[model samples]
Target chain A: MSSTNNQDFLPRSQKWLQISGWLLPFLYVLIVAALYGAFLYAPRERVMGEVQRIFYFHLGSAWNCFLAFFAVALAGVLYLVTRNEFWDHVAAASAEIGIVFATIVLATGSIWARPIWNTWWPWGDPRVTTMLVLWLIYVAYLILRSSLPDGEKKFKLCAVFGIIGFLDVPIVWMSIRWWRTIHPVVIASSGGGLAPKMVHALMIAVPAFTVLYLTALLLRTAMHLHQGVARELNQAVLERGRP
Target chain B: MRSLKLIWILAEKDLRLEYRSRQAFLTTFFFALLILVVFQFAFDPGSTALREAAPGVLWTALLFPGVIQLNRSFQLEKEEGTLHGILLSPVERSLLFSGKFLANWVFLVAIDLLIVVAFVIFFNFSFEAKLAWILLLILLASAGFSAVGTLFAAMVSGIRTREVLLPILLFPIIVPTILAAVNGTQEVLLRHQPQFLVRWIQLLSAFDIIFLAVAFIVFDYVLDE
Candidate 1:
């Protein structure tokens, strides 16, 4: 109904193939098993009790958020060099997913921190501060994209910001890491500093979350593709005046 | 030699324009002064607590008004359409960015000195050797701030609400530099031992180098059509 979504003008018979049907179902099963592994199979913490369970989702979300934003930055480079619409769509789609995952990371992180640290937020934690800044950067990225009308200008501007924002992560980390915050480092070079069961839970949880993020990105990209078709159709009709 | 001279020429052009109009110079200077004055009313200037907190107050006063100068720096070029002219010239995009960055750094340094003087008098600080260290932190932090700020300013200059957008986009990116500047200033001003001063200075210098390099390389995308 909206001007942005006038896709009915296109013939409806062009059914697009979606998902590797059996593979889709398989992923859902794996995700369910991951949930069980996290909640049921994973051993309880002697120290923090049930509150520590939030770490599984929190850690997974954190990993996926990093991956998604890295894609945003890579999309930026690809779009700049190739000037391809596909890369731009990928960048936009990943940013939407990245923000959602970042929110999950922050929300679950605070929940875990409350019972463990007796605080809702630890402002000194470098990881939390860095993630918050990443959120702002992507929010600004989305705003900058929408502010400009459809043209090379928007693509160029958004791409520039996407790259800049990603590159900033290390510097933010370096400065904030100097603070002796109480945010514990779980996963390190030797592996996660946790029990075997907890490590098992994390290994399953991270893979499943990766699947979720990738699926969400694929769906979002498909929606953008449809929108692009409709936009092109709209322009053509305006040019012809009587199509 | 050629690149350095080009940077000088471009920086001189901005300085000359500011000299004639005096818009940014006057506004940025007074704006910083007003921030310090407003802050003075909030705290009893003679108290030890206020003196302990002086470094943060001084840097905030300097940085908030500095954003205005950054925004104005590019707005003038965009308004006059000289930005496009500069983009089309034979010079490399990174070199052009360096020039703009140099001019912005100059503007920030000039205004910062004024703030330091005003800050010292209003806060009742001694004119000590430590002032030199504080000034060095200012120089290093200003380089990092303006390097990124100049790049973001150009990106936002073409937008309709750039006055607001510039700060939103620029502030988060420069957090490290601001942290370093404040901490380093704190060591110089508030502490007797000043143990962390060297480390904070190192952080600021490292921040400047990394961002300056990134901004220089990424600037081509900002200007490229």
Candidate 2:
């Protein structure tokens, strides 16, 4: 009678997954081309020289990371309110993706910083430290979920943590302001923001990263659904044999 | 109204149990004291360096004992299955949270007092800033921590890697409180700037309110088996 079971959910979404998976590579190619045009064909940075080229992917990755975590916090709230396994599954997937992209954001920032600051690492920088903390919070979150031996308890505990652990996000973001306020090294803001050329590069790259994010989230959630179905089926078969 | 009574009951129970056995309380106190002594030796007595680092050193002293006490807070309940029993009771689950919060807050207060007294003797810092405000900051910070701690403590009770995971989960979120408390206490110590203490106080106070409110509203979900 229940058409909403995990097994049934998979067959319907299978086609969408297949389509996105195939087109993802092409999308990446188009994004890289647009990015190339923005950075090279557009115009050159008058001040920072070639080093400013990292802006496209940097802001793009950072945006995706922020959205990934924002999704986790939103999913967390939904999970707490509804107490559903699907929400928890979606949350876990989003957290893993967030962690991956956050790492990339840090990596690209380091590469950018090296040329700009002459240093690969900058401690006490608010965004960097906050992102690192965000990484750790979700890392422990994943660990907490995995340790529960794959049962209802695992889902419930993770949902609770997903909701609570996000309290660190804003604090992490504003820590620089609250503590030191020296990070970010703002080049400009608003109408005076990144040069037209750099802005054009970001427009291409941000959507590129977003497309990648959606594709990753969908694929990961589908995989989790598949494994969960397999587990339930195995449990059903085991119970029948026992009887 | 009833919740406050329940909280006091739980706090008194923990205090009575501690008074009899004395293991948990003394372990925490000794652990904190040893760190203070270590800090004394680690830095030169007459050096201006130690004075500069006093906030960090004092915070470190409080943090070590805080973790130790928090780790032990749930041990008795877990062993006897009292936590589950408590959840199954007719009392509201949020009351259960309040009960734990109060008990742990008391433990922390006792520890804080001992540390502060020892801090004055060992570190040679003056406490003339404003005793009432300083105490208020400590209470607010402790309450925030105990609220979050109780929730995490319950979550970690059934897990295998709780001992290590608890700190990993709790510390990053509470960093603001520690910073505010440490810096606020430093302001109290030096008497250089009084206005900045208000900001730190506001920060810690805001954190305390947020954690308390969240913990109360969401704690029922945590008690679900």
Candidate 3:
């Protein structure tokens, strides 16, 4: 495990660790500031009241969720072009974090919807349904990754899926939007313009969540790289021990 | 022109194999029939509620059995080791995707017609001129379904959990197809809404083009060993 070849892996892994080490304290402060911005800084909604506070985090997570999935597709394209395993790690890590943010988006959206929309799950809302479908697609991507053994085949196949999944998103949203508009359900419109103060809170919360997503993506990707190196070392040890 | 012939030859090869055995064909049709029967029993058959829900039932029957066919499309190739032989040949990867997709689309459309007939009978949809619209919906929707399905089936062919994994990987991405298909069927059969049906058909056609192109481009990676 400690061979000279293994030594080459160390610095790369440590570089990521060192970067995250510096970023972690900043992430902590940013998150605290974000929570403050959400709970106390943003003005309470006149209509939805205190529960509407969830919007800041929800909107932030929603923004980053789409961004994360875009990263997955971008990484997939890079991996295909370069055949570099690093992009696969980026794809995988982005997908995992994307699912987390999507879950937050759905959960927060659902919680907010209960009082405002008068339903926990609004099937009539295109954006809501689109997010749900997006969540399911990436969840399937992760499942496909788990089912396959680790190799070029796994990376290549996952990259293909990531690209296809992202491409499907816009069409899914459009179709659902059309479906909902035709049916014309009676849900309240969520579209009124936001106040300037509320926008300021969102600006803070969005960057805070964005930073958090980056930190998680970096850490998870570094861990995947470490796992790859460990597997190679383990294989070498087993082969040397045999016969 | 020669490329088209090559693609047709590849598709014809799979079609000929299936035509010879007819195993997947019979089983897939029977499975689709069973789904319709199961739905009939689950719902109050011949009731107003059942009429309302028939479009959902029809598409569900159509969608689920198609997965079986998709899985088998590559499973047969993998089992016979023909995939390796095909890969060894100097065929373009995109052409290979089109050929496999064409075979799957043809198989799906054929079986989907039978399932639609069975659906009409079980759900009490009349044999009318509007049924032609249903047929068109089947053609467009199956094109999109098979495009994505062929790519994914090739992807999961080597994995152990492919049977379960294929649908999990497939259904979400194909939600637009399902929504459009079911709603289009409803517009034709229940509502008599030609204008709305046109919109649904447009969605299906758009989905078909987008996914077919995507699957064609990305298929090179799925088969890269």
Candidate 4:
């Protein structure tokens, strides 16, 4: 009976469940298409050979990292303004995804650099350093959330950090960029920029990753909604029974 | 006027506690001095490598130990349950933040000055008038550091394992200040012409102001009951 009441209360979650069920298979197919475009179709670099292929997915994950953090920041602001638990759900989910995708960006870059730069990690790379700092910041943000006692206070503090941590993205980029240019360049390679086929691959990879992120967001938020329903039930019980 | 009195009262209380026990102050000072001594041994004395790396070394010594001071700011409050009594007062939260921030900044700067003297002596850096510039940088950097640090310290003060958690949370948020301070020190100490010194100082000052204002406004949330 309560499960039926939960379904009635969460009609929108049911709609999202249907939408995700329809979308998940399509997203996987897109991911496969992106893989094929990146690996099977795109031309390999003459200078770096096959290792250059990591750029496709590396850049793809980088895009999603920025997108996810921006979503976290936006959701945080919305949560503060609306006092809505759903926005907290969205912010926390996006922040966690941001960390994962950012780690992918850094890891793939490290692997790519090993063969090209003759090192597993190029400490001097501004982009790489910025990504590491961003990774650290988000890691700390996640830890902050988990360590806080479970309550409205936890959500509020996390939201405040979400807002403050967003301030670092620009600073990280600028400081790293400045640091890179200030020192003499070691990898004086030409900018191939992007070939048309490579661009096409990135296009597919970006949306594929984006859709995957959205799917994760949907599922995580749905789970949060379920927990939220329990909280609401407790609150309602207090309201009805107390006074 | 009442707020000013309260801010002073809060800072004075912290200062007196430190003066009596010198727990955070003495330890923070020794921790920074120990870092200099450790690094001093790691490199050859008066080696060119040491000269080149001095600025970065100096900041690592200062900032890491400064974290000790930051953590102590609230840990003391939590220990005595004074934070609860303080928060229950009619005083504004931001004003309370100002008091804590002021106390931390002053202590950090004082500890930093002694470290700088130690740094110069250990590295065999020539004493000169330009040392004043390094002092200014420390002042601005410590202001920015303690502003955010006090806020974060109060935040993590309630949690378990906060002694470890404080630096993890504090460092990333204050990266720009660290970068600016370290770079500014590099220009001041290492370079002859020192063109970028002004730019780093500008960044440091800008971050100090922006973070001070933002932390003040945002602190009310962290202090939420």
Candidate 5:
């Protein structure tokens, strides 16, 4: 029974590992190309200069951050409907990755803002405030995840939270936008009309970061499955030794 | 008809129990009063800055102490093992959520009224007809606050750090409600125009409806054994 259970876990994890292995070199090449596109190819803007380059990675991370959160909500709904542990794993892993990307988005935005907007944090910008709230909500999701022991109960609760958090994002954005209108708008809107090379850099950078997120998600989910297998095997060994 | 009655029964049971003990009621009220007093000290009493911040101060007092009541809502059920008994009942789980949400909403509104009165006296705002709008804002905001709070309180009830975890989980999702509530109060009390009051009320109503529906739908999963 123990050996069969171990084998049951192996094929799925092995399949994910194999896929990630194939993607690894491709991911590497994409990252190199993306770096080249962002740093050397994209022209320095007339105003922000070298600091403007951070927008490539920042925008990429921001896009994937929202994408990863959407995946979390989708996985949550799938888990609730299907009652599959795999979807729960997907939700957990996606939430973790989403948080990492959100942090990157906030940090990069702040770093860029300091030089360009002349402030480290601009509370008046709806996107900035909304992103901060988004970060807090997901961090709370993680905290809720950690405080509970591993079980179906934990998964169900986390899924509920994940879904609710995702639903609140748009409402948060709207309310913050309205609230900002009442106050003085602090940060001027970043000038639009990107240069074509800049657009090309952004296009590459977005896909590269997306691929990175996928790789991280698959590896993390596989790790969780392996950890479960390890725990089960350890329990089996202890039971056998009892004789 | 039966479901509504069942929800009221559940809510009434909680309210009756609190009316008997009155521990949570008194402590939560005093805690809110303390927050109001602390703000008074933090900002100069009756100064223009304090007047400007009065709406924020009022909502802060109203919101933070409400957490104590929410935490205790489930803590009592858990302590007596009544939660399991309630779960084993024939009641629909969503109805169970409504009952809890109603109890919380009613409780918060009651406590907040006294706090608002205290706010009026401390801040020296004359009780006027416009104050009635503040009452309406409290009612709408509490509906949203209680809807989300009861759901989260249930989610975290089984955890050890539920007291801390509940607020962290709750505050972010309710930012819109807070903004609407504070600004709505500002319009009624501080500003003369009251131009944006209708807009804020609309936002609050939307928040209450959306969250109440979402909480009602997702609640079945929250209590499943």
Candidate 6:
């Protein structure tokens, strides 16, 4: 429903979507293959056995969560400077996908942690708690948008929240470091946790998950842009009817 | 000089109003106190290990009261339609922000001091070493929190669900300051080495400056329309 007025920008956004859609399947297949190689083929850990296989995917997802929030911070600065809707869309889209990835990270980390650390939840670990907090914050972002009526106010409010949320990253990192310092490190030895084959399997799995993450983000943004177009047109029609 | 004068006058007006009604402070303090009591029950107080949890408990107490006080700070302006009147004034709108943030910071800090003392008594935590350093960090962190808080409260003041929305928006960002303050205070209570507390204090100062400058700039934009 977009007009030709912004054809240049609109088409690129559509193209990104198309390309992302094409990439998702290829990326998923690559990840599945990598997981297969890592789990079944890779030499099992002497200590963790089958469960060490989850580490590669879990680490990859955690890496993606950090990247997502990093993008969000950049989006915040750009939105502050330009006041453009495009960057806001990018931020909102990234945050949504980031939350999804973070959820996977949390779940998979727990699964991995249980077999190795012998605990489902590890308290005072900075990374885990920070990601959870970040997940909650962005989830609150969605809730916030729903609570506000549609208008400029919603945009500005979300933008401010986006910028402010950047402060949490460093805090989370530091809190973890401090927490680690306070707790006595009783388990220093992994006891020959990873074999060469297992490490090789993880290398393949890492990038696969990252590519899948980027693909999902691009696809989500494309659909969001389409919806924005539909909304503006509806508002235009409603305004035209009033006069 | 005149603008400074205006800032003070507005701040004094706010303080006087709060002094007369006292509801804002009363409710905010009560809210904080109630949360503190709740946290005591939420955890096992009989255990000696509970003392280390003091910082976390202090932060939770401060967080809710901070939001409640922020929401009420602008309620008077909204009720009297004085916000619009103030907007019409030639006073640099940022001054209005300065006034509001100052008053909020002052009131919150007062409430914080009481809570910290209560926290010490309840937890039996020692605050013997580096008392001044800890107080400075707390005040700086309070300034950082209330500065952004004042800006957001104004931004959402026009919205229907501002009451809930402010905390939703404020808490995520405020976590860092809470981290610094709580960590720094923990160091003091534990009598950590001076060098360690210095680093946390430095972080608090950096946070204060960055957020204050941000709110100062962005506040003008928010107030304009």
For model 2, give the TM-score of chain B: 0.92
TM-score of chain B of 3: 0.98
Residue pairs with colliding backbones in model 1 are none
Instruction: Give lDDT tens digits, candidate 3, residues A5-91.
Output: 334656887888788788889888888988898888888888889998898899999999999999999999999997778788889
Listing every candidate in turn, what is its Cα RMSD in Å to the true structure after a full C-alpha superposition? 4.2, 2.9, 2.0, 3.4, 1.8, 3.5
Ordered from best to worst lDDT, the candidate numbers read 5, 3, 4, 1, 6, 2
Candidate 2 local distance difference test against the native:
0.75
True contacts kept of each: 0.68, 0.44, 0.95, 0.56, 0.95, 0.37
Model 5 chain B: lowest-lDDT 10 consecutive positions: B190-199
Candidates, DockQ: 0.60, 0.55, 0.89, 0.63, 0.91, 0.46
Regarding DockQ, does 1 or 4 come out ahead?
4
TM-score for every candidate vs. truth? 0.90, 0.91, 0.96, 0.91, 0.96, 0.86
Model 2's DockQ score: 0.55
| Residue pairs of candidate 4 with colliding backbone atoms | none
Model 3 fnat?
0.95
Chain A TM-scores, per candidate, are 0.86, 0.86, 0.95, 0.89, 0.94, 0.86
Interface RMSD for each candidate model?
2.3, 2.2, 0.8, 1.3, 0.7, 2.5
When summed lDDT is taken over every stretch of 10 residues in candidate 3 chain A, the lowest stretch is A1-10
Q: Can you write out model 2's per-residue Cα lDDT over A39-92, one digit (the tens) per residue?
A: 676576776677767766777778888888778878878876766666766888
Tens digits of lDDT, candidate 6, B81-116: 888888888888889999998899888888888877
Tens digit of lDDT per residue, candidate 4, span B97-175?
Answer: 9999989988899899999999999888889999999999999999989987988888888889788888988899888
Model 2 alpha-carbon drift over 4 Å, by segment: A1-4, A22-26, A182-192, B127-133
**CA lDDT, candidate 6, residue B9:** 84
- Residue runs of model 1 more than 4 Å from their true location after superposition: A1-17, A20-23, A181-192, B44-49, B192-195
Candidate number that wins on lDDT, 4 or 5 = 5
